[model samples]
Target chain A: MAGVRIALWDLPTRIVHWSLVVLIPFSWWSAENHDLERHRWSGYAILGLLVFRLIWGFVGSSTSRFASFLRGPRAVLAYARGSGDKRLGHNPMGGWSVVAMLALLVAQVGLGLFASDDDGLETGPLNHLVSYATAETLTELHELLFNVLAALIALHVATVLFYLFVRRDNLIAPMLGGSKQLDAEPAARPTMARPLRALAVAAVAFAIMAWISKGAPLAW
Target chain B: MRTRLIIGSVAAGLASVAMAQVPSVAEQVKARQAGMKSVGAAFKGLRDEMSGTPDAAAVKRHAAVLAGHSSKVGGWFGASAASAPGVTTAALPAIWTRNADFRKAASAFDVEARKTLALANAGDMAGVGGQLRALGGTCKGCHDDFKAKDD
Candidate 1:
């Protein structure tokens, strides 16, 4: 069957995904170099991205929505059995991996908000909210969670490679270009969520992040 | 026969003396960790206070505590506990492998801490902040090569 290029991932979804791809490793590098200033900025960016993704999950385009991808056990089983649809968006098994990645990222950023370096010099923006001992514990948890996130990310890349090679699917290409080759035009062209709405959501996310970075003063 | 017995007795006596000098490994590890925690706590206190309205008296107190801990750091780290059985520490083997450099780092921290105390006493808050960063850099220098990484 001849496949036609059709719209798939919307602009916001593609932007968010690509931004995270860059930010995650950059966060790791900053931490490794003891560049707390850079690390903190990266953390703020990640938090903003996560916030946007969470909101977008509810209201973004069809392929980007949780309701569209998250499926029941039967669906997952069917997917495992190689009987599920593979034309576009997240496959059933892949949906859970997406959720897990998002959940781990949330935990990582949340812990980072209260973490401090061993010397007590480099601290999270909201480190003031917790006691010193509590901050230390959060720092430890933050370290531990990064390990988990790194492991999941390795798994994610390996899975994508598996699809690329074994399954003969080019998952990476669509994420970059925002369209998939479908045998027929999608029954309904994906509802590309409005750019104005994405901008509004992004503004809210960055505002909240900036406020927190300032220790979230009570005066305002 | 008498000479042989006398030499054996002397060696046995000296062996006991040497054994006595070797401190309890467990206690050393615990005490070393306690020193680091106290330093960390004091440093954290000073940092937190600086973030807002700093109490001069408290700044002096925290700086004094930091100085006290820094002075004792070289001793705590002098003896390697990396190979102690049934005990665990984040101190990497390099702390001992590069022993001279490790001691130098510990000395640098001590110098910085004493200077920090002097600044606090002078009520030079800005100077104190800059010194804190210098002090932290000593920590980073040591941590970079000597300490195990978190991630």
Candidate 2:
């Protein structure tokens, strides 16, 4: 059957994905090189992206919503046994991977807010909210989570490559172009995501980050 | 007249010896590393004093030491110091390539260090603490750009 081309990812989702692709490496470099200012800003940017994604997951297109793809364990097991190929959005297994990645990212950035390096010169803006000991513990967790994130990113890339070459599915093109051609009937035709709503959500996320950055200095 | 000539000759010899004793690139690197270690120690001492009932005298002493070391930081990063062969140093080639930025970072550190010293002398422990953090940031800024990754 001739495939029908349909909209899959929204502009906001595409932008967030690409921005993360660039910003994650930059964040790693800044941290490794001790460019604490850039590192901190990058963390905030990631936090903002995560916040936007969380909001988008709720009010986005039908395909982008968490309810669409986050299937039960039985569905994931069925996907693992080779039964989940005709869907339009994320496959059941891929959906869980997405959730795992988002959760890990949230943990990483959340710990960073209270983290401090050994010299105490470079620290998270909200570092003052906690005791030095608490900050230090969070710092350790931040470092550890970075390693975990790195490993998970490697795995994610490898999975994408496997889908591209072995499964003959070019996930990246659809993610970039926001549309995919399917050989079978599309699972569901989702309306385009609302860019204005995305803008409003992003504004709210940025404002919260700014307020956190201002910090409670008197608490320190 | 003969005594005067002898004294002049002796002075010229001493001057030649001083010129001949100029440190090698490796020696300069080592000297700078030592200087930075001392600065770190002094900064730590000042930070420790910030805890409770700060010793104003100790604060002044440590801050003065930090300022003294900060002033010498730029001089220590000589052109050849980064390229010195057979030396195990964390100094990266960017220090030479991005000379202007490096110098700016170093000078900013010096300015912050001096400010910190003034604050310490004025018995403003809180101000000193804040300035010290800024001073350390300048150091980190330069190191991030110019120092090779140890890991």
Clashes of each: 0, 0
Task: Name the regions of candidate 1 deviating beyond 4 angstroms.
Answer: A1-4, A86-88, B1-22, B78-87, B90-104, B118-127, B141-151
User: Which residue pairs overlap in candidate 2's backbone?
Assistant: none
TM-score of chain A of 1: 0.95
Query: Once model 1 is optimally superposed onto the true structure by TM-score, how far is the C-alpha of residue B78 displaced, in angstroms?
Result: 4.5
Best by TM-score: 1
**Which candidate leads in lDDT?**
1
DockQ, all candidates in order: 0.47, 0.11
- How high is the lDDT of residue A44 in model 2? 88
Expressed as tens digits, the lDDT of each residue in A33-118 for candidate 1 is 88989999999999988999998999888888999899999999988998958436899999999999999999999999999987
**What does the lDDT come to for candidate 1?**
0.86
For model 2, residues B32-66, the per-residue Cα lDDT tens digits are 98887677667656755764458889999989998
Model 1: how far residue A216 lies from native, Å: 3.3
**Model 2, range A1-220, lDDT digits (tens) per residue?**
5878889999888888899999889988998877889999998899888888888899887777898889999999998998756667899999988888889999998998877654566678777556656776788888888889888889999999999999898999999999988776654677777788888988988877776676533433
| First chain TM-score, candidate 2 | 0.94
